[model samples]
Target: MSTTSLTDRLGSLLMAPVHLLMRIIDIPLRAVQKAAGIGGMAAVFLAPNMLIFGIFVLLPLVINFVYSMTGGTAFFISERNFVGAEQYQRLFTCTNYLDPMSCQEDAFWTAVGNTFWFVVLQVTLMIGVSLITALILNRDLAARSFWRAVFFFPVLLSPVVVGLIWKWILQRQGLLNFGLYQFGIEPYTWLTDRNWTFIATIGVSIWAHMGLYTLILLAGLQAIPKDLYEAAEMDGTKPERVFRRITLPLLAPNLLVVVVLALIKAVQIFDEVYVLTGGGPGTSTLYLTQYIYETGFASTLRNPGLAAAASILMGLVLVVLTLIQLGVGQRSEKKGKR
Candidate 1:
């Protein structure tokens, strides 16, 4: 090599160690500075979010509990001067608490029962329908994208809009009736009938929800290893056996996720019920949340105290349910690990 080239090459080789040492020396300090900066920035940014949460969520909860204790016209009353569990007692005992005509029994408890049934039915239907849709979409079906979009379209629509649309469609003179007319069948009042109303609401909820659940299950299906299915087929396993042994076991985590989400959504249903039936046809579709809203805001009594008590009770129930779900999930994970 020429002298200049030789010297340049030697300098580069000598400088490499220095560069490496500098990088090593600087990394920890740079990392420490970055972490500190991020910590400080996060604190600053989260202050507003924390304030908003306290104002909206935490404050309402605290106020609810406080109000639940106080009795009568004035709102600001001391917890010491509080009526204790009288609110809870009245929730069951007092016929005039919310509904005057329904005085023989607690409407709150009835609403609770109805809400539980609604949740159970809707969650089961939602998970089942979504799982089936997900499996079909996961296969090498024609117009896959079109089918996915079609299935998920309902999820994009607002619940209120969906309820309104379905209400129109299910009316005696609506699309359903029109189709029935062509078939020479008598038109039925879907919303007017109690059993039919319940069924209609459940159907609408399932239709609106399947898209999201299907998407979630489809993602899970994609994550499953292809080799498992191949091995199952190689062993001469029937399709049913393959699904039960391979697909179900592998999809357990996804199913759990869909179930939990469906449960929460079903339990908290309001808009659809409100728009479709307005908790009407003789309180047939009156859910717990609707009861709470009506008691707190819509009714003439407007007992904030009772509403708060009901809310706290509902929150406790939700917390317990969530804990149960978590426990189930943990057990499943452990089993999977084994």
Candidate 2:
């Protein structure tokens, strides 16, 4: 045979078993399609994903809610007694709502306070810094790609590694203090003071996660039409005015996404802060997630039911944030259509 004919024969030989397997599969699938139609086939294809979601997500959520309502330190669901909303009641039972010391679950309230401040400060700073970084990176600069990579490198690191790196820099006798010592200044413990520790947590968190937000806002910035800026420039429009009229309006959707995501992430902050501070300077850096984790798994007096209740409360906050995001998104979509 000629070379072309020999190649054709080899290709046909390779495809033969694949074609045979498809033919065998199609026989049963044709019968299924005739009986159930296209929609049924879609459901059949989706069944595996749905089963995985139910097992991993829905099942645990139901179990957590159930555990929240029950009392006792029992690991087994059957062994625990259902005390109704007793765990919630204990959490809410405070002589003064503002004072954690007056509450039955004082550590929980302290965490709530710390988390509230952390969320407010961290989210605000995170959004501001990310926006500034994004704006700067969007401009034409030397080694632009390298600068972008440098800014985003922290995001590629594990949260624990971020914590450890910052810890080494901020701890007593660490890099920061050693620098101060070299400058003929007394070494100071950055992680020991309560105020500084809390601030460090916020700073470290912003550093670790800011790269992702910067990338997000940078994408948004890039997506804005250069034509708009050009038009504004031709008309002698001020930079501030151009940004206000064109850039901000165009970037609103991406800004909305960044805000909601950052808000949720700030609420759930744990690993990095945990590794950095261990909820000390005496619970100053403690947050809701860590509170739940310690209560559920790490505490000497482990209380899963109480932990579940706290988690459910936290989940409710997240649900509200999600609903607000959905509402805003829908409203924006409606406005766009209008």
Candidate 3:
């Protein structure tokens, strides 16, 4: 080799160990630098979301609590001037609190009972109907996509619009009455009868809500392995037996999600009730939410404190219901594992 070439080779050979050593040292340092960068980026991203959550959800909850403690229509006062849960007490104790319109009697406990009934009936019916619809769509039927779309389309429409459409249909001179007249039946006031009105409201709500639930359940159903069903069938299991043994167990998680969602939505139902019955003919269909709205904003006696208490109570009920669902789900999972 030439002297220059020989020198260059010798230099490279001498620096190789140094280069390797530097790389070995840099590896840990680079890892530490990357970790720090990732942590900083995560903090930056999370900080804004946390701030927004605090501003909106947490702050409002705190404000509601504070307002509940204070005896006020407009101004915030000391909790020492607090009525000491008198508002809550009155909800149970008060009787015959008449609406100014003279159209209905508004009893707090009665409204609470009505709301409970509404939630239970609506949630149960909504979930059941959705599950049935999902099962139907999940089957190997002709025009499956068409049927799925037909079922799910109602969910895309706003609840307000659904209520209005149903209202028009159930009107005295509407399609329903017109059809009934062909059978020589008189036009019945669907909205006027308390029981019928309640049923109609539930029907409208179910129509609006069932589509979303069906879609959710259908997705869950599709995720389940077909092999499981085939295995069940090969073992001489009937269709119902196969579904019970295979599908229900596998679909437990999705069922939990569906039930909880239904419960929450049913409890929070306001729009359909508002539009369909306006909580009326009487306060038969009047939900807890209607009570809150009327007390806080619409009525002659705008009791923010009372409304806040009702809201807080509603929140607590929802939290309890969710916890119960989670507990049941966890128990079911443990049982399945065993």
Candidate 4:
């Protein structure tokens, strides 16, 4: 058989089912369009996507809320006893709201407090570092591509891998301590000490994720109009003044995106912190997600209802935070437009 003939046969075989599937789908779409015009045609195209969203995202959300209302060890929703807001009451029952130790669900409250502080520090540091790096990388520099890749490499690694690698490096006799010892600095406990452990986790989280936000900001920087900069240059504007008057205003939208995304990511932090700290040194680093998992799956009581309730509370916090961030962003954008 000739090569051209074989290639032609292969193409027909590959395209045969594709053409058949399109025909099969097109017939129903055309019939719907003929019967109901634009609305039906739109529905036909949208049905699959809506079905997917409902099955995957909406279904789980409904199920989670259902589970949050129930009590007992039953895996099936129907079998579980509906406890109303008992779990929420348990969560909120506290002598002093400011002091986590006074709460009925002390562990849960501890996790909540820790997570609040973590978000504050992590988001602040992450944005600062990402902004600085993005600024540097946006300018013409030596091996800029190589440097960007180096920074982003950690973001590509699995959360588990990054956690383990950092754990090894931060251990008592780990590579970090080894380096310190070489400089006549005594070994310090990075993971065991309460204060140091938190600082370590926060630092690692910032380091692991900053590159992604940097890329976002860097893209935002690139999209700014060059003519604005050229005009600034012609006016003999100072670098700082140009940045403040032009770059900052234009970059507000992307900066907003980065802030919102980074905030969400910081709030939901679990995998890396879990693998790295295991909520260790007496649950000092236990974030809300880990606390939920440990409550539902790993605790002696196995309270799925409580876990679900905690998760719901966490979701509410995140939603509120997102709304505030978005409101601020919208106002900033409006001001920029003006």
Write one digit per residue (lDDT tens) for candidate 3, span 1-338: 59999999999999999999999988885776587686575665577899999999999999888767656566454533576686676554433444323223234455677788888898888888988999989999999999988888888887789888998899787889999999999999998999999898888889988888898889889999888878877888998887787888777777887888888888888987798789887888888888888887788777788788788899999999889888877987787699
Name the runs in model 3 displaced over 4 angstroms: 1-41, 75-82, 94-106, 325-338
* Candidate 3 weakest ten by summed lDDT: 97-106
RMSD of each: 8.1, 2.2, 9.8, 3.3
Q: Write the per-residue lDDT of candidate 2 for residues 123-155, one digit (tens) a residue.
A: 999999999999999999899999899989999
> Where does candidate 4 clash, by residue pair?
none
lDDT of 3 at 124: 89
Cα lDDT for residue 110, model 3?
55
Residue 244's lDDT in candidate 2: 88
Q: For this target, which candidate reaches the highest lDDT against the unseen true structure?
A: 2
TM-score order, best first, reads: 2, 4, 1, 3
Number of colliding residue pairs in model 3: 0
The CA-based lDDT of model 4 is what? 0.90
Consecutive 10-residue window with the lowest summed lDDT within model 1:
96-105
| TM-score versus the correct structure, for each prediction | 0.80, 0.93, 0.79, 0.88
| Residues 138-235 of candidate 4: C-alpha lDDT, one tens digit per residue | 88999999999988888998889989999999999899999999999999988999988898889989889988999999999998878989999999
Better of 2 and 3 by lDDT: 2
The digit string of per-residue lDDT tens for model 1 on 1-338 reads 69999999999999999999999978885766587686675675577899999999999888888877766645455523578887777776754554544644366777787788899988998898899999999999999999999999999999899988998899878999999989999998888999999888889999998999999999989999999888888899999998898899888888987888788778888898889999878888988889888887788867767877888898887787788779878987787799
